[model samples]
Target: MNSKMLQRQLKKLNLNPEEGPVNKKEWQDLIKLIDVTYNEYENHLYRSHNTLNVATDELQRLYTELEAKSSQKIQVLDSKLQNIMSMAPCIIMWLDNQGYIEGCNDYFRQLLNFNESLDNKKITLSDLDLHTLQVRAEEFIKSNLQQTSFTKQIANYYFKMTLNKMVGQNKISILGFDVTEDFNKQNTINQIQAKAVQSSKLAVLGELAAGVAHEINNPLMILTSVAFVVQKHIEQNKFDQLPEKLEKIQSTITRISRIVNGLRTYARDGENDPMMPVNIADVILESLELCVESIRYQNIEITFDNQMTIPAIVSCRDTQISQVILNLISNAKDAVLPLKEKWIKVILRQVEKNVVLEVMDSGSGISLDIREQIFQPFFTTKDVGNGTGLGLSISNEIIKTHYGRLFVDHNHPNTCFTIELPLA
Candidate 1:
């Protein structure tokens, strides 16, 4: 007898239960074939289920390994970031929207002289001892600027600070680099350069001493003649000519006063002078007053060509600029004094947004080999005792400080040094 489930399946397959099999042999063969098919189907189903379970287990194992690796990589990156922040040579700080200290790196803490960690400390900008930084930070916060930079002095150290506002966040970051050494070094260099410039001025004065003496002597002779004439008039009781003679005397004295004043102004230290907008033409004229007499005494014809229709106004230290002009004029005089045709011409003009001043002499242009080195400190073509070689170098430096350019105009027909300064 077959099982009840198999008998029902066989009945459904059109084998009637009430009527037995027509052929007993064929009926048994059909039962055997059905049993074989059912077994194959059950084995296939079990293999598919087992494969699915194994695949699920593999997927879980891969996911766990990926997570572990990701976690380890994150830890490594975090450690590196921490080390970089701690070892950096600059001050780094973060602040909340309300200007309260949020966090800072080790350098920042050390800069502020903090003895304890600021992890949970509640501190405001004003609560710190940095008054200037606090004030500037407040100003920056109040401004619409997203970032700004400035220099501040704290105790004995100087710092160039940069402040930035984080985008899409109510936070500010402050970065600072210690610049005390650089600042002090620059100041010392400026001082030395100032002295060198002053010394150069004095040297020029020494060269002009003879011409200055002659210049003053002429006016002195006129004064003396006028005084003698006035004395004669007083003795003769002729008061009418006295007024005219007195006017002449006054004019002569004024000329002498101007020469002396020019010398005094040129000899002073102008290193710390504030920059002001001045007419370049006026600077040239004033600079000429100090050396014009000297040039004329050497029979060197000097002329000024002011081509600008308007004032060539430039922002600069006029005194320092005067020194540059004087240095150039002195150089021009030396260059042409030995030549038969001696002449110096100063041309002032405006080019685009710049004021250009050219000091040209009646001589062949400088050779290319030496032109490149003319602006180097302690490089000169003059006799050993005749030149300090710092004039051109100092002049170039001064022009640079004024945000201008000084160079040799090799294209010109004559030897010329050009100064190009931005218009004020």
Candidate 2:
């Protein structure tokens, strides 16, 4: 039935081109008239199929050309609308009174992982709701007005679900953003903050330990001095019997003193070191010392190639710089641990009034697509509990403050981070 109707519609369209679009208030009405005329002609399609004179055929041809031009004009308007909808960044979807995804844009399909060849008439939001998305949609549609819009966690991240009712059509359209990265980042930040507080508490305990160590050092020194004096007197032949005991006491005191001092020395750095002319080489060495345990634990061998003279330095915050180095080395260690060959290199070079500290490792390098976005705050490739994405961003910010630059080096083998600091 529709085929016969289609043939008549084509015939009418073929003839109508000879006639032009009648000027009117709006072009839509004229276009509709042309379509309705075709539909009517389709009713009598078989009766007059291919039965026309040369003059009638000529008239039909003229009408067909005019109609084709008119149709083209109408299509241009539709194309404009489609272009707008399809190119939109926001997912735009439409549904009838029945909560189905009747029409959707390219962005909308991508958001839902909908097929590229998805058609407007065939699919619905409910159809594509593989992960209980349909259930959420149903809940939204069931409600008259959902002011308290909430979030949905799918896979490892969160997405905000919003629904808006089409006022006239009694349909609903939803707009959504994949808040997975943002949500995960926020949670990590919270965890980091909590960890920092805990670390501060531990640091305070370390400070107390330092005080205890300081207190013990004085008595330890006095005992050692007295024991040494007694040992010397005994050895001079006045008290041979007591000399052996005196020597042992002095040895015990010295041992205790060493333990006390070591406790203070290994604390989490006193405070952020004041800005100074810090030797870049010295910082690198100290950072190596700081990360030695971690590096060994990960079994990642490190080679430090310092091409910079110890005299080559930069004026910057020493502790922050140290933290930056620590973070970078830690990142490299973590990255290289999974690889078959565990090797990390800390290469420092003095080039053109600047010092560059490069941490290169035989590790899984970053993907090319995401390489540019790696420096963004709260960006990470590590799993949930492994890393707090802030390391590179914080390092970048610290370097920037000192007129330095920190960036990933992709041209080299494996993963690399290069920090360049201006000497002056």
- Tens-place lDDT digits, model 1, residues 109-144: 777777665667778767777767777777777779
- The TM-score of predicted model 1 comes to 0.74
Query: Which digits, one per residue and each the tens of the lDDT, describe model 2 over residues 1-424?
Result: 4455445544544334458763453345446656776777786774566455656889999999999999999899899989988887665666656666667778766666777455556555556654476666667777877433567764444767677777767777776667878888998987775465335334333323434454456557767777777867867976855766676676767655544443333344523456688777766665555445446655778889978655767898765676677677767776777788999888988888788888888876778888988877668888886566766776687789788899887787778899988885
* Candidate 1 lDDT score at position 2: 40
lDDT of 1: 0.86
State candidate 2's TM-score.
0.40
Q: Each prediction's Cα RMSD?
A: 6.5, 22.3
Worst 10 residues of 2 by lDDT: 200-209
- How does each model score on lDDT? 0.86, 0.68
Q: In TM-score terms, which candidate is top?
A: 1
